[model samples]
Target: MYPQVLFQNRKPDRIATLEEYRKSGGYEAITESLKNRSHKDIQEILLESDLLGRGGAAFPAGRKIMTVSDDAPYPRYVICNADEMEPGTFKDRVLIHADPHMLIEGMLIAGYAARAEKGIIFIRPEYENAARILEREIGLAEEAGFLGENILGSDYSFSIDVHRSGGRYICGEVTAQLNALEGKRPNPKQPPPYPTEKGLWGKPTVTQNVETLCCMPHILRNGAQWFKDLALTEAGAGTKIYCVSGKVNRPGCYELPMGVKLSEIIEEHAGGMKNGAEFKACLPGGASTRFLSREHYHIPMDFNSLREAGHRLGTAAIMVFDEDTCMVAATLNLLEFFARESCGWCTPCREGVPYLKDLMWRIEHGQGEEKFLSMLRKQSKYLWISYCAFAPGAMSPVEGLLNDFEDEVMAHIRQKRCPFKGGE
Candidate 1:
């Protein structure tokens, strides 16, 4: 039996109604915590669970909650970061669309644990259906005495709100998200004053990813020990919804236990490559992560395992590429996305990504030279070392392709055209 925390409904398209969700023990965790536990006690349970943020960074969620717990007078706030903007990452939307009430219940539990008085779910604009579903659910929760002013007749009170992002990738970053919520351009700011200290109109605020917040209700319902036992590895605890896409036979979101082998995920869960295609390389966690070849397919899918295998497990989105695919063309497609999504705040990202994209295009078209390749490599290095994570993420696919698929690049250079052309 799987933990009811993640897949309580179990149906692929089950959007839990407020009545159905409450029947399935949805608000029981929040009610129990609010009635019997203190803020410090809740924080202790979370810390014991060893729950790391499900967002790309994989930071400790309990530590983040503690940072904002002791400060503010009253009315501390929790923000659910639902801005699922990472390329090839679509699991958050799946969760929201399937069970928005689960997220609402989880956010309510987090607000209680953090002693926060207000909560906001910042969803991306492209997820219009998710936004709508959440909006309706929040309205129902509010009317039933679960959301507004006095929850379950306790002295503590919390309110929930929903805001839509303007379809920018940077809005997924914590600092930039704060800026967007404040009616400013969504650009990242210096982090000496982290969001825990001064966030959301200068109040104590803690922001968590949609998936991260949704895990809270389950952690509180089942003891921390039960949650820890769910992991397939030591470094990561709990199941993850891995989003597999691009050239795979089964391109969809999978709820697999952590530390499952990458090869198992591909060959079994994802049904391997499409057609008669042979695997060439894969970006283990979306376009932001580096490429891994057949040798790395045996690596476990946990964060630490992926890191040791030489890639960050970003959002657990694995984009597979077949042997017939051109690395140069694939990299160019990623660069195009990054360049278009850049906030243009810093020079390196604004100028550097487009420059790299242009070079890749020329190379794909057979107009590139050895000198152009060398220059592109140097520029990629510079961009990786630039201001924020945006540039570094943008540079990853290009650098990875060059390192793992150099022969493909050389094939493009020598053949004066794509070798995959005309199905040959």
Candidate 2:
């Protein structure tokens, strides 16, 4: 309803065909960009747009593109990171199903902006159907000359392929994804040779999230100023693909202004809390981010605004919970997933996550020691020095429990039972 550029052609019950997308001026940007704009012009326009990466980190998309030097080696790669493994995150799957060509067109333009020749959509194994749709649509795109070998009669040529991952949460990490793509054991490689400098078989590769890449085509289609004006806040640009779930009546994807308030996203768009349930808290961004208590109910849901409030809009996967939900048990549940999915590559993440999970489990089951609280706090900070961000992210809910929901946690320890569970 709010100017759905991305979902403009989203058809209910079935994916939009190439004809529908084309009719709505889908591939028009790539065509116009290739014919008139130089690669530098593309770079400048993105910078002006102030588009940040939708993938957790919120890195500047323009700056990331600029990293690939114009003089960088040929046959560079631009990987569309479709490994949407974060708990409570599934916007990528919805976006892919709604319109596959949008992704293809976005990647074609991304490949051009990043000076890349090959584009790869590195998706997780669970998304097999989406992968097949992408493959089918890609074949259609090539047949229509939107991809492969002098696209649209321009000198630039690019090809895109969908690569199914072995299906691990670790594979979503940038360096680990590159390793997985190369058939190597997926381990987080410390940077020095950043992906843009050297990646994916020792070549300059630009890897971006599916949502991040999908933004490019639209940004290019609309002028930079127009893109900047789309956000509800001065700090944000364009619309955000929010994947809202849990406790909300309408738990699905919504394309809204980047800086829409968290309250409005819930009360207005998502049909408010389920069954008139009183809102207790929410993981404002997927499971990895800290919980947003009722104190910040009206907080602006944008990267900069969230950061200013000591929070993050990581993937904007808002997982809401009603007052009847138990915070301690909720945090414990998230911790278990993080511990189980840990790659076990580094000591902090390998051992630390499970160790923290055990402490939370004991507390929830009436075996908690007050000492464990201090230990949890200590370990959460200690894990930050891990090989990658996996440990810190995994420990976020733990940190949130200790910080925001300490009273609930203490209630469990003192009562020797989960407060939310049925009384004996």
Candidate 3:
């Protein structure tokens, strides 16, 4: 177990009501921010804390706050990106469901800092309970003078709308999310005029993940140094909600410090492997991240540590695979999801993902030849030509297959069938 800043005191088997959350000293950050602090002050604190985005990319959240154009003709917008579509990623779902007001209060502080009058919670439709909880909490906040006109009798005013996503993985991408929110076809638009510059309806917008925003209130209440000291690593700040699944005795989300070792998370936190199963490899983060072998288990699970080890801390969703799991079959299963979720906007992602999936399926089913293996490897390399991160992320499992599990895949080819057939 590690620090539980996010989940501490959370009620088991029940969603935290607005009253309960408020009673627990919630909304104090936004109240202090609006009544006494300015946007620049908030931004400076965040910058000092070095809190990276909790979304897959791990970008700096404060940098996004500072870059919004206040002089833009249109009102700036803030979006709470709750589109948790990445496979094995459900921490956001838990956050929204248990402590919806945490996200709401966090958004209020974010909107205040960005000078954003309008905000949107872009929640995935699949998370019906979380969406409902958030919607109800937004109303409660409005009635309590935390949202809508003249918040806390001050000049600052902000309102939030919860929008159910159209159920595409692409919508998790900020630009594509803006497009979908604007009632356009969901697709990733090229960057340069990034969301901070020109976003929803061509207005400057700040989009942050649900967990990233949830950290805002704590940073405000505890101060930047306190937040920085909470991390176990030099650069890492705050706690990470690790969603552990697959072959683990404890298959659920655990809030751990940033630099907690992977081995601790897998063995101690996840209660070791289920039924004494030997850990073969893990996605470490979500499906998009590169796999980490048991040898890397002693390393810290921070952004820099994982990246230094040639992997990403994607959404911090740890998916462990036991020894009996077939690497080739697992790779194919992930590719099939990517192929189905492709937005079909560009040829590389639209066509390439499905083609890769087909190749992997053939190889998994024992129809693979040397050329098919070569094509799988080559296609994984070139899928980066796609419009957005989708295709490249789709190829992550393939990357793991080629790099760490090549012998496992070779066994499939040699056996002329998956070695672990009928045994995922």
Highest lDDT: give the candidate number: 2
State the displacement of the C-alpha of residue 261, model 1, in Å, after optimal TM-score superposition.
1.0
Q: Which one wins by lDDT: 2 or 3?
A: 2
- Tens digits of per-residue lDDT, candidate 1, 1-424, equal 3444576665665686888878877888888988899978888888888888888888888888888847566668899999988989998998887777789888887787788989999989999888888888888888988888888898988888889998899999898899999999989987778778788888888999888887888889888888888888888788888899988899998888788888888889898889958888888887788887878878889889988867888889999888777778888888889989888998888899999899888888878787877898899888965668988988888888888888888888888877777222
Tell me the deviation in Å of residue 270 in model 1.
1.8
lDDT of 3: 0.88
The alpha-carbon lDDT assigned to residue 24 of candidate 3 equals 77
Positional deviation of residue 378's Cα in model 2 after best superposition, in angstroms: 1.4
Which pairs, if any, clash in model 2? none
Q: Give each model a TM-score.
A: 0.96, 0.98, 0.98
lDDT at residue 345 of model 1 (Cα atoms): 91
Q: TM-score: which is higher, 1 or 3?
A: 3
Order the candidates by lDDT, highest first — what do you get?
A: 2, 3, 1
Greater TM-score among 1 and 2 belongs to 2
Model 3 worst lDDT window (10 residues): 1-10
Model 3: per-residue lDDT, tens digit, 1-424? Answer: 4667888647779988888887877888888887789899999998888989998998888888898865765588999999999999999988887888889888988888889899999989988888878778888888888899999999988999989999989999988999999899989899888888889898889999999999999999989999989889997899999999999999998898999998899889889999998999999889898888878979899999999888889898999999999988888889889989999989878888899888888888888877777888777777888788888788887887788988887888789998887447
